[model samples]
Target: EDQVTQSPEALRLQEGESSSLNCSYTVSGLRGLFWYRQDPGKGPEFLFTLYSAGEEKEKERLKATLTKKESFLHITAPKPEDSATYLCAVQAIGSSNTGKLIFGQGTTLQVKP
Candidate 1:
């Protein structure tokens, strides 16, 4: 069975603190690894797409990387505005791209000013 799980259901960080969130996945075939940031009451915003191990993508203070078995989202110098839920998803090659995503519950981050 294909599945994804994220650690630390919630995180509290002081402004300027840096931390890393963990994402563990198991799938029959990894077609793509996706990372998204979701704010309250809104759909997830795409952040990165990693295809192979040792691959990474970054924007602003956020970085995402994928490996053979897992992925990670690292936040550097987080700010209050950065507070949001981080989600990780995977797409399998057998799927029909019908917008079905196996999502982790999400890691809620809170940065205090």
Candidate 2:
């Protein structure tokens, strides 16, 4: 079955601490991998898209890298404002190009100030 799994379902980090979040997925025909940051009571905010293995993207303190079966979100020198539920999703081939996604359980991060 095609699915996505994220580890360390919750994390607590002190401000300025660095960490890495993981997303593992199995899909029949992968079209894209996506990352989003969700704050409480708010919709997910798009972070990155990875289309192939060895592909990587970065924004601010977040870096996303993809491999054949997994992807990683590396947080460098995180701040309290960066705390949020990070989500990973995959879109399979033949699906509509209309921003549809199959999401994994998110990883909730709390960065202490």
What are the per-residue Cα lDDT tens digits for candidate 1 across 6-112? 99899999999999999999987888889999999999999998888899999999999888999999999998999999999988767565546788889999999
Task: Please write out the lDDT profile of model 2 over residues 1-113, one tens digit for every residue.
Answer: 67899988999999999999999999877899999999999999999999999999999999999999999999999999999999999998765545568899999999999
For model 1, the stretches where C-alpha displacement exceeds 4 angstroms are: 95-99
Question: Relative to the true structure, how large is the alpha-carbon lDDT of every model?
Answer: 0.91, 0.94
Best by lDDT: 2
Give me the runs in candidate 2 sitting further than 4 Å from their true place: 95-99
Location of the lowest summed lDDT over 10 successive residues in candidate 2: 92-101
